[model samples]
Target: MAFEEAKIRFKGSISPVITPFEEDESIDFKLFKRLIDWHIESGSHGISVTGTSGEPSSLTIEERELVMETAMKTVDGRVPFLPGTGSVNHRETLRLTKAAQEMGADGAMVIVPYYNKPNQQALYNHFKTVAKSVDIPIILYNIPGRTAVNLEVDTIARLAEDCPNIIGIKESNKDFEHVNRVLLKCGRDFNLYSGIELLCYPMLAIGGAGHISATANVAPRQVAEIYNAWAEGDVTRAQHMHFAMMPLNDVLFRDTNPAPVKAALGMMGKIKPVLRKPMELPSKEIQQEIRETLMQYALVL
Candidate 1:
């Protein structure tokens, strides 16, 4: 599909799948492929790997590239394959993004430079350089809580104006006003995805594209249903799914990211609850909470 046509199709629940690991802390390619196929079968509009949920920062460049290759190969153009290719290092970001383009990925999600706290101009330069380098669509990831820096709305609009391929953004911040401002400034056609799970329905309600959420890892059908409901003009059903998903969303983030999500996946017997170093399984208390929440949704018995 042409990039233009693909942008329209990208406006739905895109699952940022967790990178499953073995007990030895190696990437579980077997489990990873299974998760991708499951997401597609479960109704995820698209599949993303190596995002925050996938623990991109923990994996090496080679490992990240391998994950992207695996996702693209598994997806096989069944649904859009968007891989998170950003890093704190610009060179590494460019390398992975270039690889994504060459590997036939539909688009790439590049995160804001974390820890360094680059100013708005520096952020612009970073994205502009990458967008210029790659031919595929670019989705800027703005998670101030994790990155310690916000991609200001003006800077976002500027990037959209300056780089045509810098087409969309994943607004992970809690501030809904940022979502409004991006749409107002960048135009309604600019694909704005809500990375915050709770904001998914609201984002779609406001002329935004869709969500690239971690919660979708456990509830892909529900999450995709929310978007499908809204698209079909069933506001009532959409709202129901939105609120129904709240508890699961909360539990998934009870700890730091994919830990809770990975745990839930294990409980469902989809994959083993394993994470790389510095990211162990969720605590016993949180694991129980996750189980209770999933039971409420009947995801686990």
Candidate 2:
């Protein structure tokens, strides 16, 4: 699809889902399928596999393909499927984006190039080039903390203006000012999905489309509920729900992303808290804290 066409087709709350592994520490397709079913059943608008939360860095190309294939087959058109296609190198990124489109993914979440920290012109050209390379819509993922370089508002506005395929951004910076600026600079065609879970309600109030949240991995229904209620103008209900989730969100990141999320999932008896090497399980103390919070929220065993 053309950029203009893709823009119209993509927008909403999507989770950067966790990849589950069996006791042998391989991608566990059964538990993976169950996790997918849980997300869709809990009303997640879409799932972005092989993302940060999915430990894309740890996954090989074949492993990524397995997760994407399983997610597409499981969701099966019930919800949009978005897979992470960001890499530091352009050629690799294009290969993945094209792969995502070929595998019947609805869209691709392309994060800003990390490590090398390209200048503004390079950033613009990078996204434009990859976006032009594929038929699918491309949502820019700009979480500077992870990537090091931030996508500038002016450049982002320009990208949205020039590249019709560059539809939206997941602003994970946790800076509401930045989110507001993006909303102001780009207007409605350029959707801004909150990358940070805690800011979803506030972001929505300022015209953000929704979230690409990590917290959704543990409490899909609770996080999705805030968006649903806020959209319907139920501010009181939304605020209550948002407040209730702060501790849960904090716990998910107490270790570092998917570790805490995977640990929490294990505690819930949903999946084993298995992560790839170099990323260990959260400490027992952290696990206790997560359990206590889950108890407080009444979300545990």
Candidate 3:
């Protein structure tokens, strides 16, 4: 399918799923596949792999390939698999982008360059180069908090205007103003997803497409329900769900993300909470707190 079509079709509650690790801290293929199946079965509209939540930086190329391959195989064309193919440079991003396209991913989530911040032109060129290099659709990821270089509204507009494959974005900064700016500036075809779940209703209020959420990794139903409810015009139900999830959302991200998410998943028997090197697991106190949050939500038995 065309990038724009894919973006328009699956524009809601896609999870940047956590990569499951074994006790040895290796990728657990079995658990990973199960998670993918579970997400699909649980009603999440789409899925993203190798994102920040997926611990992309810590994964080896081979490991990255493994996760991508497993996700593609498990999803088996059931839903859109928008894997994060971002890297610090164009070549690396191209390599991963090409791999994802070849593996039957519906599209690639290309993040802004990190560590080596690039100018606006460079940023434009970086994404342009990748879009030109790949046939699959490109979903721009603007999580400036992690990358330290925001893909500004103008830059995003430029890319979306210039690059056909650059169709959508995952906006994580939770800045509703910026989100609205993108929605206002970009054409109706442009799909702007809220990477921050807290901004889902606000984003939807501003004509934003949907959300790429971390909470969905644990509460897929609740997360997806918020979108469905809102779309169905049940704003009250949607708002209630979002407010109900806020406390867990705050604690799930109390530390570096995915850590708390993985920790929460561990409590739920989803996976081991062992993050890769340089990414520590959440503290016991924090874990207990997450567990309490889960219990309160009745996500735990």
Candidate 4:
């Protein structure tokens, strides 16, 4: 779809899918494809690969590109495919984003440069350069907890004004005011997606486009339904779904990110629970918590 069409269709629960790996830490393309199809079958509005939940930092550029390729090919226009193509290194970010554009991805989620801690001006230049380089829609990802530098509202507004393709932001910060300012300054047309699970419903209530959630990796139906309920004018049902997902969302982050989420997927027989180096499986206690939580939700036996 064209950027104009994609901007409208990119709303709702877009799963930042976990990158399934084999026992020896090899990318499991076969299982990865299955997960893509499963997300679609389970009502995910879109699929996002290689984001935080997908372990982008661990994967090589080639691996990240391959995951994007697999995701696009498997999705095959069934729904929008947005692959995370950001990195601490601008060159790598450009390379991955260029690949996504070439492969026909609907949009690209470029993260704020991590660890380097660029100031507002530097951040502006970094995003502006990338946005100029790509013809596809660029969704800025601001997770200061991970990236160590917040993409300030003014900086975001500047990019929105300067780069038409720099269309949206995935605000993962806990502060709702930041999200408000971005939308306020950038205008309602600039897409905003909640990266925080608990804030997903609230974000939508405040005019966010949708969410790109890790919890959706295991509960695609519930995540998607939150948006569906709200959109269908069932505020009561939407609120209920949001609260119902609280326990599961807590467990998914009991440990660091994809570890807990991947383990949950493994327990549900969706994929192997292997993780790359420096990112191990969740602890036994955490695993027990996950199992009990899933069981409580009837996500497992």
- Per-model TM-score, in order, reads 0.98, 0.95, 0.97, 0.98
- What tens digits encode model 3's per-residue C-alpha lDDT throughout 9-56? 868788788898888888898898889888888989998899989998
- The RMSD of every model to the true structure, in order and in angstroms, is 0.8, 1.6, 1.1, 0.9
- lDDT tens per residue, model 4, 1-301: 5656767988989999999999999999999999999999999999999999999999999989988999899999999888999999999998999999999888899999999999999999999999899899999999999998899999999999999888799999899989998999999988999999999999999899999999999999999999999989999999999999999999999999989998999999999999998999999999999999999999999
Model 2 CA lDDT for position 176: 80
Residue 7, candidate 4: Cα error in Å is 2.1
What is the lDDT of every predicted structure here? 0.93, 0.85, 0.86, 0.93
Q: lDDT per residue, candidate 1, 132-162, as tens digits?
A: 9988999999999999999999999999999
Clashes of 2: 2
Candidate 2 achieves a global lDDT of 0.85
